[model samples]
Target: MKNEEKTKKRKAKRKLSTGLYKLAFFYAVLLLIIGFTLGVVYDSFISKGMEDEINKIIELSTTSEILYASGEEFCTIFPRTMKEIEEQTWKLGVMIDELESKNRIGEDLKLKYFDLQVRDFFLVKKASKECRINPLIIMYFYTNNLVECEECYEQGFELAIARNSLLEKVPIKIYAFEGKTSHSVVNYFKEKYNISSYPSLVFIYLEDGEERWLKEEGLINSNQILEKALTFQNASS
Candidate 1:
């Protein structure tokens, strides 16, 4: 019976090993399912928040009459609102980048995002003019490396530094557009401004109560152009 006992013990050990492997596999599958659920939940939460922020901006833009009526009060309210809007816009940009990288964002959504951004720009520009503010617009057109956009980021950075040095008195607005945007706004801007290059930097200033584009001659030396513009503006006013 010793032999029989040895066989029974061996069978029991094999059964225990199989049971342990099954348990480990079950736990592994459970962990994978849990992780996947959490990721979905997190993504949903972020998307909802992003949608809410975008909607608020749209609502604000749509009711621009309220903004126009602010008069002096508009300037008081503008800085804070602009900061919030810019922050949200930056976040939206990050989201767009991520979605685009994954090939998940659709053309419709991309166009809508660009539309909202452009709408905000016009609203801010109009508000600045009504408030008698000299607004500077620096536009960056990046094509996600699909095409060569030489020095776009560099120019944007240099302009940003210049803008920051101005001490926030001037309403300097910076906007970035994916040149490959599946929207008409890109074409509209290009046609209106005679923009031909990918990394083209356009500086817009208010002149004689109308929007005017700064000359190309002024652009080659970026900082000098801005300084001269500032000096001329200061002397003019």
Candidate 2:
């Protein structure tokens, strides 16, 4: 009777051990799945947060206004191809039509005058191998109201005449205040960099996906503009 009781006790103990082992295995698998799921969720959240931050920085920092203005001015001053000239003519026509529709006859005439002046400025049959600087500077001469309209017109004419003599160099982008406005592109750069000048030249260098600004004085001439461009090129290199 004692042997029978011992056998029953042994059987009960073995069943308990087996049950515990099964429970532990199930729990281990569940924990591993839970840990992997949490890890994936955390990683996704972190990646999304980083992308948002990067987008915000781009929105706040990119100087698209300046770039656009510069591009328009470039097209106005020097069109490299026939297509560009046609586009400029179309733009002038549109401006004339708009001004006439507004009953601004004098302004429409001035627009026509300006269109002719721009065409004469850019219609050089022979481009000097030299004077390769970007034509945006001439555009600034026209766009900036700091100078009188007549003065701007004369400057554009003079620039065209001197185009052959000036040394050809790569284009350097400079930002100037358009008017006394709070949210102007110039204001944006000034607020960001504490700039205090009318025609501040901000040199930007992009390295390893980071932008770095170089300290430089304002530009008035083509030479200073070229120097700033070279500085940015060297730093980026």
Candidate 3:
């Protein structure tokens, strides 16, 4: 009778152990499937976002060219086109920033984004020349994840407000770039402009039929910057 009782207990314990193993295996498989599905969805979302940005750029380029050829002023196209481009640019920046925060961005996407930015910069240059309007290019450079300058944010905010105020007088565009950008174009800009610090502002204008860049650092006074911009415009004109 004792031997039978011991045999029964051993069989029951083995059954329970087998059931637990099966449950664990089932959960592991479920979790893997969920992870894979989420990964696919997220990848698709990222690709779609990039595609939208490219499309906006293409549309902006085409529309601006058409408007210019039709004898439209730079400010005239603002409500219909330029404003949208500006908004999209801001949105793109925010999206990339969020991705950077999550550390989910890949090198390939960053390279592509940088390439797009270079193209956009050239587009702005073309617009400035062809449109023949008061064009202001503020090149804002700073570290994304690190603070290279303590006053960079304040300086940037000041410039942004200044840009808004002069939007009517001058067709101003702000191109915010990461100082530690790996893009070769940024590297070229850094070398050409002698950018050595964070929160560097490069004010570019056409001087003597040649594109010129002016760098500003330290505590930025928006009013002073605006005056210089006006002077630059007058000189160019």
Candidate 4:
């Protein structure tokens, strides 16, 4: 028993020295503190920037009636505003990617952003209809429910591919939303489309001068999106 106790004491003594242990611990804590501090700073900056961006986008919906008047000079604003919207889309996309990389694609903020995108889609569609311009749009519905939406991430990735591919050839607007969100507008769409599962899609476009809205459920790949989009757009053989 004395030998065993002696060995245990020796092993304990072999561990890091008290001062060294404390110093190492202090360094570790210091690093963690620095990391957390930087994270907070980044979050605050991003949140403020995003709030400003959203407010700007919302302000866009209030363009003067003169801009929408049925005059060639007046109607020029549509294309300009659309271009601005597209630029804003790219900007928001970059911010979203940053958030996603940080594992901080936060719930309410992200959903609110998506909802704002949907509102933008509505404005664009309305303007297009008034101007007799054909507008191609897709509404992607997904849930953040971990148990329910296993493929939502894949769906989003595939969607990005399809969006990039199609944008190379045609003008299209794709809006994604958390279908099960508590927001009344999103919830209304969830009920309207009978969304029971994850990764549902709705395609809206003008066909034969008539607006067509179609729905597809389950996980869809980029190829499928391209195919359906081309078909609904009346460009597919």
Candidate 5:
């Protein structure tokens, strides 16, 4: 009877050990599966993030390429004389007015014309002093929550004329901003001067590091725009 009892106890002990081993094995497999699943999820998330960043980079590169290409084209076909620029400006205005009347200027077309005006009318002018006041009269086309086009042809028509009227004026540099890539520069100016408009003009003097902002209300008239530019110029000087 004693031997039988011992045999029974030994069998029970062996069974308990085997059961514990099986349980541990099952849990190990479960833990491995869970880890693998988590790894897959994390990898997918990382890959998607990387892809989004790459797409943004590509879009910015394309925008810059378009601007550069457009500038080159403008330089190639630009008129050699101020008289020719004036003639082209008049023609462009007529076309733009007609387009606006007919609602034919799509967003893309507006952006293109805006860039064209900047390159042809503003940058192409050789006379630095004559171009001084032109910087104050920028035409901005807002798109994608940013300024897509900036030309002195439409919105700054009078300002351009005023700047051209003055002789021996100080040279002013105009910086064009487009797309989200230009947001940094725009925000910098806006923050610096507390600007609150899309096409706001800020006259900057590098000599004294002074900046004057022209608000949206003042930009309604060409004369007012020119006055603001002149004021900024005088203050900076």
Candidate 6:
């Protein structure tokens, strides 16, 4: 009777483990499918000339300022791509927050997300340069693990509120990035900026005819954000 009971317990444990693995896998697949579906639907609506705008961005990646000769040129096509960049990056930020909240994100989706973010980061730079505006940049970096970086979502929420408040007064823009992606661009900035911790914010602004940045670790309130943002806002003015 003892030997029979032992065999039954072993089989039961195996079945339970298998069920948990399947549940995790189902969540991963469902998230990816939802992501892909949303991408397809969004592209269909904004399909016209989107490819050309992206190519322009890609060219800017190589030549940087050369492609952006005049504000007029970028002004014409840049609005559409600008809209695309903002939507893509912002939506992914929301998706990341949602995934972390539910604890259901997979490794594959995160890699894809990081790629879009890096690309859109370049687009933001391109837009600022061509538009001849020294926008106050708020770069929020965090990871997928909620347990590791629980404050990340709160940071995002506070920054969103700060942006809403400061947009008219300071020209502030907030962008969220996944800090632990394997993407080379993400890795490069991580090393260059000494980003050793999660829930990091990098504030980039124009000062003394050059670009400068201030890095902060952990969560910060909207009031603090408004303080630093207004400082840059004054400097640029």
Using lDDT, give the best candidate's number: 4
Encode model 5's per-residue lDDT on 1-237: one tens digit a residue: 999988887884333578889999999999999998997776556445534443443354344345445655433332233334444444454454454434544444434444444454334333322233223333332223313333323544544465464323543333333223234444454465565444445444322443234445233456665565667666655
Candidate numbers sorted by TM-score from highest down: 4, 3, 1, 6, 5, 2
Clashing pairs in 6: none
Query: Could you tell me which residue pairs clash in candidate 4?
Result: none
Q: Which stretches of candidate 4 lie over 4 Å from their true place?
A: 1-16, 64-66, 69-74, 97-108, 235-237
Residue 44 in model 1: shift from native, Å? 4.9
Per-residue CA lDDT of candidate 1, range 185-222, in tens?
A: 87788677776666666667766676767433112345
Query: Which candidate leads in TM-score?
Result: 4
**How high is each candidate's TM-score?**
0.64, 0.30, 0.65, 0.79, 0.33, 0.63
Q: Give me candidate 5's TM-score against the actual structure.
A: 0.33
Better of 1 and 4 by TM-score: 4
Q: Residue 183 CA error for candidate 5 (Å)?
A: 13
- Which consecutive 10 residues in model 2 have the weakest lDDT in total? 124-133
TM-score of 1: 0.64
Backbone collision tally, model 2: 3
How well does candidate 4 match the true structure in TM-score terms? 0.79
Query: Quick one: RMSD of model 4?
Result: 4.8
lDDT, candidate 4, 1-237, per-residue tens: 999988887884345569988899999999999999998888878877886787787677456234555445545577667767766865785576457546665665676676677677767777767765565788888765658888887888898889888877766777777666677777777787677778888888776666778888888999999998887766311
Clashing pairs in 1: none
How does candidate 1 score on lDDT?
0.65
Model 2, position 126, has a per-residue lDDT of 18
Q: Which runs in model 6 stand beyond 4 Å of their true positions?
A: 1-72, 76-84, 100-105
lDDT of each residue in 1-237, candidate 6, tens digit only: 999988887884333578889999999999999998997676444333333444454454434334455434665566455554554456555755675455445555555556656765666666765565567887888876779988877887898888778756654456676787777888888887789888999998877757788999988999998998888767765
